[model samples]
Target: MIVLASQSASRKAMLDAAGIAYEAQSSDVDEGAIKRELIGVPGGDVATILAEAKALPVSVGVPGKLVLGGDSLVEVGGRQFDKPVSREQAAEHLRFFSGQRMNLHSAAVLVRDGITVWRHCETARLDVRQLSDSFIDSYLNREWPAVSGCVGVFRIEALGVQLFERIEGSHFTVLGMPLLAVLAALRAQGELEA
Candidate 1:
């Protein structure tokens, strides 16, 4: 089994649905501080960097065992959104994204014995349909608690699916893991069945 260096429910669901064996644990790093220090870095690169930060820590604990870390971020008009800070912010994200296209960047890193081994990043484009103020309000009321933990304030597999009109990318990438690539990497490393 691999060590999943994140406690995100979405990531856990993705792995569980894939029948992948893993242990979930938090890296406990301050992601906000990393973002602040990397000011002006592109969203995709930031995601890749953060993935390594999480994976490296857990790899240290398990010695030679594989440790996986992943992160997802949303980019709208060059601005990146992390999980919402409040219900108001979540609503604001929806308002700005209404009738616009946003790119969701998901990245994963694998490490062994505290050394980086492999990494992958994938991007998915989502077109959010025009949304009315009432819809935004009701959406936050029903979904904020659940979605607030997700970047873009969405969990595309849930009510969040209603917010999008079109999506272009791998389904798993949008769900926040480059899962197929990750599986391929694991198999390549002799950690999973070939």
Candidate 2:
């Protein structure tokens, strides 16, 4: 059976929508600590490292089960934005993203029997329309609770799509799991019927 080492509702929803059978378990790894340790690495590489870190611990305990772990971040210019720590922070993040194009990096690792069987990073570019202060405030109030690791202030599945002018990437990657790449990896490993 496939085990998903994350508590992300979006990831679970993606897996379910694809009709993939899997078990969900929260890895509960200290993500802040991992990010801090990887501070010296490039932002994209940091995302990959964080995903592997999350998957490895779960894989070690599950014996032969295949475990999937994922991490996503928003990178603009050179800075990486982690989850917002407060409403104010969320608002600030939205302001930074206003009228700008940014990159979203969603990285995943699939581990089987304590070894990484496949890995991928799905990068998508999003153009945020010019947003007013009031819009930012309202969006933060409405979306902050639902959005945790999301770099942008809005949840694309919800009202968040309205905030974007254009999104150039796979829909699944923008959603956070990159389902196409995951499917390809699974098929190659003979874990899924193609």
Candidate 3:
């Protein structure tokens, strides 16, 4: 079984649905500090760094077991967006994202004994449909607190799908992790059947 270093529902659901055994553990990493430190870095690389940060700390405690960490970020119009802090903020973000191309960067890392053994980052491009104020209000009314945890202010597997007009990338990537690459890495590590 792998040790998961996040409480994110999407990542946990992905592993659970894929039949990957894992135990959820919070990494306790300070994400805001890391993002400040990584100013100007590419979104994909930032995701990888955050993933590694989460994994390395957790791996130190569980010496032999593989610890999996994952992170996702959203970049639209050269601006990086964090998870919205409020319903109003989410609405503002939705307005900014309207009719814009959003780049979603999802990354994952495998660490054991404080050493990273594998890392992967994938990017998904989503063309957000033009959003009207009424549409944004209605969308957030139903999706707010739930999507508040999402970097893109949306979740692809749920009502969030309505926000996109076109998407060009792996479905798993848009869900917040590069799950295929992660499964492949697990197979390579002998954690999963080859």
lDDT (Cα, tens digit) per residue for candidate 1, span 16-118: 9889899987898889999999889988899999999988877888987899999998999878888898999898889999999999999999999988989
* Candidate 2 ranges beyond 4 A from true positions: none
By summed lDDT, the worst window of 10 consecutive residues in model 3 runs over 149-158
Model 3, range 1-194, lDDT digits (tens) per residue? Answer: 99999999999999999999999999899999999999999999999999999999999999899999999999999999999999999999999999999999999999999989999999999999999999999999899799999999998888999999999999999998899999999999999999
Global lDDT of each model? 0.90, 0.84, 0.95
**Alpha-carbon shift of residue 107 in model 2 (angstroms):** 0.7
| Model 2: ten consecutive residues of lowest lDDT | 146-155
**Which residue pairs of candidate 3 clash?**
none
Off by over 4 Å in 1: none
The local distance difference test score of model 3 is 0.95
Better of 2 and 3 by TM-score: 3
- Candidate 2 lDDT over 1-194, as tens digits, reads 68898988889999999988899887878878888887767766777888888898899889988899998888876678887877888888888888888788889999987789888898889998999999987876777777755656667989899889999999888888778988888888778987
Regarding lDDT, does 1 or 3 come out ahead? Answer: 3
lDDT score for residue 182 of model 1: 93
> Against the true structure, what is each candidate's TM-score?
0.97, 0.94, 0.99
> What is the Cα-based lDDT of residue 121 in candidate 2?
90
* Highest lDDT model number: 3
